[model samples]
Target chain A: MMQRRPMIGLALMAVASCIAVAARLLVVRTLDGSLVVGWPGPTLGQFRVDAVLVACSAGAALGASGAILQTLLRNPLASPFVLGVTSGAGAGVAFASLAASIAGMAAPTGAALGAPALAGALLALGCVLLLSRRHGALDPITLILGGVIVGAIASAGSTVAEALLPPERRGLLTGWLFGRIPEVPDMGSLAACAAAALGLTGLGAAWGNRLDGAALSDDEARSIGIALGPMRTAMFIGCGVATAATVALCGPIAFVGLLAPHCARALVGARNRILVPAAAVAGAGLLTAADALRQWIDIGGGRLPLGAVTAVFGGVAFLVLLRRTAAGWMA
Target chain B: MSALRFQSPIIARGAFMFAPGEVAPSAGRVTVLIGPNGGGKTTALRAAAGMLAPEQGAILLDGAPVHTMPAAQRAARMALVAQRPEVGAPFSVRDVVALGRVLRPASPERIAHALARSGLTQLADRPFHALSGGQQQRVAVARAFAQHEPGGVLLLDEAFAAVDPPEAAALVREIRAEAAAGATVLAATHDLSVASALADDVWCIAGGRSTAFGAARELLTRAALPSLLGVAVAEAHGSRGTIAVADYGGILPEAPR
Candidate 1:
C-alpha cells in the first residue's frame, strides 16, 4: 500500500525515542548537575533538556538534509562531509579563527560569523562545476569528486590556519570540524530550527512524482511526457538548500546524507513519494534517539559529541545496506 | 467500428524513411509489416504507435490528427510493445505489466483478462528481471493488451521472435482474437511463415523501400522467396498459397512438414 513498513518504522522510531527520553529525564531529575558519557547515571535536569533538544534537532537537520541529497543526486555518497560541505565549513571556521587572532575575536563568534556565508559561496561554486556544460548535472561520482577536491582544499587551508593559531583557538576549529553543537542559549537553535523548517516545507511542497520520473532514464521520462530541464534544476536546488541549512546548524555530519535515503528505500521501497518523507522522518527519529542515548550514557565528565554517535551507527548501517543491495547498487 | 488511417506521412530515422499514402484499414484486421533487417519496419511501427515523431506525416485515428496530440493522449488509442522490453528494476512481473495500464484506467477484471489471454497469469508474481527472455516478451505483449482503448490498435515490433514456436503461435492466436474482437492490429516480423499464417495484408520491405503491399496470398510467390532471401534455394513449396523456405544449397535442411 502506502509504505506500510516505513510507517511501522516511523512508529518504532517514536517508541525508541520516548523510552530513551524518559530514562534521560529520570537521570536528570535524580542527579545534581553532572552528566557522564559511558554509564547511565543521574544527570542534571537542565543539561538533560539541553542534550535532548540539541541531539534531536541536530539529528533531524542532518538526517533530512542527507535524505534530500541522496535522493536528488541518485547517489549513495552525497553526504555533507563526503561532498566537501563540511570541509568548506571547516575552511570558513579556520578563516574566522585567523581573522579573530588578527582582530581578537572568540572562536564560536568567528565560526558563527564566517561559516554560513563561506558555505554559500563554496556551495555555489560546487553547483557551477557540477552543472557545467562539460559536466552537466550533479551525477553521484562527479559530485563526490568535486566534493573531494573542495574538501581537500578546505582541509589544507584549515591545517594552515591551525598551525598559525597560538594553540588555544586551534582546538575550537577541530571540535567544530568534528561536529560539536555550540551551546547557543536557545537563539541559535531557533535559527537552525527555522532554516530546517523552511527547507522541509520546500521538500514537502515538491512531492515525489516528478522525482520518481527522474529515477527513470531520460528517454523514458521524455516518452512519458515529463519536461526535463526544469525538473532537474528544481531538484538540485531543493537538495542544496536543505543540506545548506543542516550544515549551517550542525557544522557537517558525515554518512547521514549518504545513508538515510537508502535505508528509507529499503524500509519503504523505491517509490519516491513515500520514500522521501519516510527517509526524513526516519532520519529525524534516528538522530533523536541517538541524542537521547548520548545524554543517558553519562558515566564520565565530558559529553560525547552526538555527531560521533550518529557516524558510528550510520557507518555500520551503511555497510550492512551496501552488502544487502550490491546488485541494485551495481545497476 | 472506429477507422484507423495514416496520411501521406514520412517517418524517418537518421537516413531511413517509411511513408505511404493514406489507407484506412477496416476493423478486425491484422496488418503485418514485413521487411529485411534495418528496413524501417520498427520505425514505422514506432511512428504508428506515436513513439517517434514523423518528419512529414500525419497519423489519424477516426480521421483526426493523432500525430499532433501529446504522447499520453495518443497512447490512449494505441499500445506499443518494442523489440526488447527494457525493464531494469525489481518490479514484480505483475507490477511491470501494470505499468502499461498507467495511461489507461482499466479495471482489475480487464487487466486479469488480458494477462490470462496472453498466458502470463501464472508467472505474474516473479521478479521481472529474473524471468527468461521469452517470459519477459510475453509480459510485454500482455502489458500492451491491458493498456489501450476499448477497440484500440496494438502495434508490435518483432514481438514474437524471442518466443518459442508454440508460445509464438499461441500469441498469434491471441492477437487474432483481439483483432476479431474489434482491434486494429499491426505487427512487424522478419519470420515470413508467421506473416503468411497471421497477416491479412503483408507490406514487404527492401532497401528502405516498401513494395508488394497486398494480401499475403497474392504477394508471397515461389520465385520471390529466393531473391528476397538473397540465397539460392534447392527447392520450395507452398501450402494453401502460404510461403515456406526449404533448403539453402547444401548448408540447411528442408522445412519440417
Candidate 2:
C-alpha cells in the first residue's frame, strides 16, 4: 500500500475541488433566477447540496473508470465511453421504458434504471472483450474497434426501443438522453453511485502496482509474476460497474471520464497508483466545476444544461490538452 | 545448482510442442541454448520460466514443479529478460528497471547497480521509449539483473539478438559476472559466436526437440555445429582462441556439397 505524500496530495486535491464547487453553488439567487454571492442563513437548499454530491460522485466514477481503462487497454485515449458502456446502459434503459409503456406504466428513472443498466453495460463489455481477443490475448486496437461496433449496435437498439415508447414517456427518455445533473436525486441512486465511485477508486488505488506492471506487454507482465487474467478481469469489471452506476444517476455526462486522467497525469506521473486516485479526484473536480459554471453562465434564458456546459468546455479543454500531450510525447 | 527439466511434451500456441527433455545448468555457470529460428529454444525457456504449462509432463526447477508455484513466488525465484519487451508509456529508464523489485520495496542502490552493470547508468533519467532498440534491450537486461537474487535463476530469451556487437559483448561480460556471483543463467540465442564466448554448457535444440549437448567449447565448432544447427558453420579464431569464434554462415543443401 502506498503511504503519506501521494495520498495526502490526492486528498488535498479532492478537498480543494469540492470546496470550490460548494462555494459556487452556495450563492444566493435573485428573483429572475440569476445567482449572486450571498450569506449562508436562509439561502442554502438541500437540492443544491445534492446536485454537488451527484456531480462529484458521477465525475469520480467516470474518472476512475477512464484511468483503469487506459491502463488496461494500454492506450491513453481509452475511457468508459470509448468502450460504449454508457450506450449499453442507455439501451437497457430504453428497453425498460418500452416495457413499462406496454404494461401501462410510466417509465422509471434514477435508481430503478440501475439493475438493467448494469446488466447491459456488463454485457456490452463482455462482448467487446470477447471480440477483441487475438491469439488468446486482448489487443488494444482491436478492443477499441470492438467497443465502437458494440456501442453503435447498442445505440441503434436504444433508438429502436425509444421509437416504441409512449408519447409522454418518449419526452422523458429524450430529456434523460440529453443528460442530467438532477438537483433532486433519488436517494437510492445517489447511494449506489457514491458507493460505486468509492469502491472503484479504492480498488484502483490498492491494485496500483499491478496496474503499473500491466502497462507492459502481457508476457512481460506475466513473467514478472503479475497474473494478467485476474487483474484485467477485476479492473475491467469494476470499471464497467462504476460506469453503469454513473449512467444510472447522471444519464451520461461526457468528457469528464476521457479528460480527467489527462489532467491528473499532467499533475502526477504515469504511475497508476497515484494516477488512479488523482484521475478520480480530477474527474470529481471537473464535473463539480462544470456544474458550478453551469450555475454561473445564466442570462434571461433558462440555466444552461449541465450536459451542454460540460460538452462545450470539456471538449475545448481536451483539444488544448491533446496538443500539449502530443508535444510532450514528441519532446 | 539449478536444473530445469521438462519430463514430458509442453504444448504452446500454434503447432508447437517441446519434445521431452532435461537441461540442468548448475549454479555459477553460464548455460546457452543454441538453435535455429522457430526452434524450441524460446518455448523451452518460457516453459522453464513457468510462462507455459506442460500438456503431459511437469517443468521442474530443481525437483519442484515450476508451473504449480504461486506466481509471485515463482517470479521472486527467477528473473527473465524477454526477447522483445513491450512498454506502453514513456516511463523513465530507472522506473522501468525498478519494476523488477515489484514485490519488494525499491532500492535505489540495486537499480543503480543493475544500470551500471547493463551499461545503462547514463540513461537512468531518460524516457525508456526514447532510447534506441539496442538500448531498450539493454534496459530489459538491466531490469532482469535488478530483479535477480544471487542464488536465483536468470532466464534470457534471445538475450543477444538485434543489439550492436559491442553492447552484446558488454552484455556477455555482465552475464558472466552474474554467473560468477552464483546465479544459474540460461540464455537462448541463435548467435552461435556469442554462445561460444559465453557458455559453460550448451543445449542444442532443433525441430521442436531439445538435446542436452556437451560443453560449449567442444560443441561450438564448424565440424560439430553444421549437422546440429541445420546451417553451414564457420570458425573465426580470436585472441582468446574460441571465445570470440564460430558463427553460422548459410544453409546446407541436402545434396552433397
Candidate 3:
C-alpha cells in the first residue's frame, strides 16, 4: 500500500496531462483555426500553437508551486494565493502597470524582474505575518488572512492603474492584470516553467523525509535530527520562487494555488513524494484543460478568463470533497 | 549510564528556565522530576532536550554547552517522549513506534526487538490509534527505547500517567535497560511508585523550585509523596510509604500523625 500510492499519483498525473494535451491539440486545430480569418501565414498559425504551449507551461508551474507549498507548510490549505506569495508578484505587476501608464510609457517595458520581485516581497511579508502570529510556521487562518489582505491591495492597485491609463494602453494594462498569453512567443514564460519544475523536483526529493516528519511535530522532527528552521525556510523559499514564476506567466490565477494541493491529496494521500509531483501535474492538467475549454467554447466574442473557468471547477471539486468527507467517504 | 548535566536558560511565556549556574543534574542514574501541576517540570525537560529555549541558561551534555547548538545536534544526544501525545490518523502499531526512531524504513529485526522489549511484539501490526491507552503508552515507550543511544539522555514527561501499574512497571524496566545500556534516563511523573522503582536519583520540584535533589530512595520517602499531593507525609517503610490522610475512605475521620 505504501509503495502503491506514489505510483498511483504519478500515473494519474500522466493520464490527466495526456488527455488535456490531446484535447488542447484538437481545440487549437478546430475552434482557434477558424478564428484566424486573415491570409494567415504559417508563422501566424504558429502563434496559436505557441499559446497552447505557454498555457501548458504556466499550468505546470502553478501545479509544482502548489505541491511544494503544501508539503513545506504541512497544511492542506497552503498554496500560492492562499499563502499570499503570488500576491507579491501580482502587486509587482500591478505597480509596474500603474507606473508605466503614469509615465506614458509602454506596458511590459519595465525591469523584467519587477513583478517577480514584488511577488517575492509579498511572500516574505506573508512569512513574517505567519511566523509572528503565535504560530511559528504557516497556519491556515494566518495564511488565508494574509493572502486576502495582500490580494485586496494588489487588486486595488490594479484598479487605480486601469482607471488612470488611457483607453489605448488600458487594454494592455488589463491584459497584464488578468494575464494574457501573447501570440508573440516570449521565452520568459518557458523559462519560468522550467525553473518552477526544477525547483519542485529538487526540493521534493531532498526534503521529502523531513517534510513528512514535520507533519508529526517540530520537536519530533528535531528529535529525529532534522534541522527544522533551515529546512522550513528553504521549503518556503522554494515555494516562493515557484509562485513567482507562475504569477509572472499567469497573472495570479486565484484558486488553482488553493485547489491543486487538495485535489492531489484526494487523489493520492498526504504523503509528500506522491503529493508534490501529483500537485504539479494536477495543476498543469487543470490549467491546460481550462485554457483549452476557453479556446474551444465560444462564450462571448472574445475568450473568457481561464481563471474563471478553473475557479468554477476547483470550487466544485472542493465542495464535493468537503461533502464527501463530511459523509465519511474519503477518510 | 553516563550522567546528564543540564545547563540552559529556558525563557517562554508561562515558563521559567533554571540558569546553568542555577542547576546541574548529576549523572549515571535515573533523575525523576516531581512537581505540582504546572510547576514547569515538563517545560524544564523540554528545555533540557532543546525543544524549548531557555531565556537565560545554557544546557550542557556531559559538561558541554548545547543551548546555542542546533536542535538536531541536541537530538543526537537526547530523545523525548511527551505525555498524552496527540497522534492524528491511523497507522500500524509498528509505524507509530517507528516514529520515535527517525531513521527511515525501520528494520524488522530492530522494530521487533523494540516491541518485544516493550512487551508489544505480539501487537506489532495492530493499528496504533485503536490501541488502549495503556497499550499506546507502551508503544510510545518502545519508540523511546528504540531511540535510546548509548550515553544519550532520554527524557520522559509524565509518561506513566496513561498506563496501568503493571504496564508502567514493565515500561520502567525497559527504561532501566536503556540506563543499563549507558543512557541517562530522566523522567517526570506523578507516579511515585514508578519513580521509586526505576530512578536512581530524584529531583523533586514544587512551587517552581527544586525541593529535593538527592538519592531516589531518600526523595521517594513518605514525606516527599505528600508534597506532590499538597499535604504531609506520616508513614514510611521497606517498599511502601503510607500517607496518613485526614480521611481514609470516610471510615476514619481525622488521624493525627
- Predicted structure with the largest TM-score when compared to the true one: 2
Q: Rank all candidate structures by their DockQ, best first, as comma-separated numbers.
A: 2, 3, 1
- For model 3, how does the per-residue alpha-carbon lDDT over B1-257 read when each residue is reduced to its tens digit? 44556543545554543432356554456778877787768767777776665555566676666556666566667777777654432346776666665554567677778898878988997766567777877877787766666778888888878788777777877787777777777889876666667778878766556667787756666655565556554442424443222212345556686
Winner of 1 and 2 under lDDT? 2
Candidate order, lDDT descending = 2, 3, 1
Q: Order candidates by TM-score, high to low.
A: 2, 3, 1
- Say what the RMSD of model 1 is: 6.0
Q: Once superposed on the true structure, which residue ranges of model 2 sit more than 4 Å away at CA? A: A1-12, A27-35, A39-44, A107-116, A122-146, A166-174, A320-331, B243-257
When just chain B is superposed on the true chain B, each candidate scores a TM-score of: 0.86, 0.90, 0.83
Q: For residue B170, give model 1's deviation from the true position in Å.
A: 3.8
The lDDT per prediction is: 0.62, 0.79, 0.64
Q: Report the alpha-carbon TM-score of model 3 versus the true structure.
A: 0.80
Off by over 4 Å in 1: A1-177, A180-216, A220-232, A293-304, A328-331, B1-75, B78-89, B103-107, B153-161, B164-166, B179-257
Error of 2 at A306 (Å): 2.3
Q: Candidate 3's interface RMSD, please?
A: 4.3
lDDT of 1: 0.62
Alpha carbon lDDT at A75, candidate 3: 48
Better by TM-score, candidate 3 or 1: 3
